[model samples]
Target: MSRRVLVTGGASGLGAALVTAFVARGDRVLVTDVREDASVPDGASYLRLDVTSEADWEAARAHVEEQWGGLDVLVNNAGIASGGRIDVATLEEWRRVIDINLLGVVRGCRTFTPVMKRQRSGHLVNTASLAGLVHPPGMASYNAVKAGVVALSETLQFELAPYGITTSVVCPSFFRTNLGASLSGSDTVLQSIARRLIDRSGTTAEQIAAEVVRGVDAGRPVILTDRPGRRAVLAKRFARPVYEREQHGFARRIKEAAEGAADRSTTKDGA
Candidate 1:
């Protein structure tokens, strides 16, 4: 059966991949993004939606009601990245990240839950990160918001179950995406390192999108795409101290690499 699906941040990266996947499967998709220049799949409709704006969500709901009558899937994939030590991050910075990454998901759920409840069958796919499950340094704000996403999704899963509404939290590791382009904060070196790692990683947005489809089909509450994400979740569950140690070591390595890059730059400049 063809279902009505909506994906936020559907302009690029994983969002675009998801849009393509759903469209290929014959689902009527509505792709929304805050970017005015965001692209939609050939058969899918496009809407300008800022997840942080309640009015935007209302407009989306109205559009869905008018066009599709109701929605079957809502993918909260819109988010921003932030990197900086907790102490160095300003209050404004924290609020900005939280508003978009955490509160955005909140607004999405709040807006669509009632609609889905009325239908008694709907899926909510929220895009979180592995950082939400296993925290590392220099990403306090991002980690916190993503973790909140996971928590919200988990709680909603229980609350919405009786209503036949499904909720899944996607916790993926690094993949090739434009998330780096919108990163905010003082961790330039860390961001550069992360960008390089993601570029070199074997994962792709299409691959993650496939996993997402499979997970939703299977009604999985927690969806993990990459090996690192899977392992981290396992370690965090079975061996929390071990996971904490690994996170600390990873943070140390990033710091060391950043320092090494700085030293090399200094050497080249002095030459």
Candidate 2:
């Protein structure tokens, strides 16, 4: 059966890849993004949506309802990145990241859950990050918001199950995406280092999207995209001390590298 699907931030990154996957499967997809210039997939319809706004979510739901009668799937994939040590991050930065990353998901769920409840059959796939499961340094805002998303999705999984609605939280490791474009932080060196790592080692958005489809099809409540992500989740659960030690070591390395880069830049400027 051809399903009606809606994806927030569908213009690029994982969301765009999701749009492609759904369209290939003959699903009618509504791709919404805050950017008016966002590229729409071949078979998907585009709508302007700022996920932080309840009104925008309402408009999106109305569009889906009017065009498709009801939606079968909702993917809350809209988010922004934030980096910097907690103490150095400004209040405004925290709010901005939280509003888009955490509150956006909340609004999406609040708006669409009722619609799905009326239909009594639907699936929600929320895009979280591996950072949600494991705490990393210099990403206070991102970590908090993503962690909130994971908790929210888990709670929704149980609440929506009774209504014949399935909820899955996608926790992926770094992926090759334009998320860096919106990254905000005072930690320039750390941000640069993180960007390089992602640019070099991250998986393609298309690959992650394919995995998302499989996970949703299988009704997985918590979907980890890569082997490392899966292992991290497991380690966090069954081997806390080991996971903490490893995470601390990784964070220490990143901090050292970032500090070294800052020092080099300082020396060059002084010279």
The TM-scores of all predictions, comma-separated, are 0.92, 0.94
Model 1 accuracy (lDDT, Cα): 0.89
| Highest-lDDT candidate | 1
What does candidate 1's lDDT look like per residue over 129-168, in tens digits? 9988878787788889999999999999999999999999
Give the Å shift of residue 192 in candidate 2.
1.2
Model 2 bad stretches (over 4 Å): 265-269
- Please write out the lDDT profile of model 2 over residues 165-227, one tens digit for every residue: 999999998878887776757777667767886788658888889999889889999899987
Candidate 2 worst ten-residue window by lDDT: 181-190
RMSD (Cα, Å) for all candidates, in order, is 2.2, 1.7
TM-score of 1: 0.92
The local distance difference test score of each candidate is 0.89, 0.87
lDDT of 2: 0.87
> For model 1, what is the error of residue 250's alpha carbon versus the real structure, in angstroms, after optimal superposition?
1.9
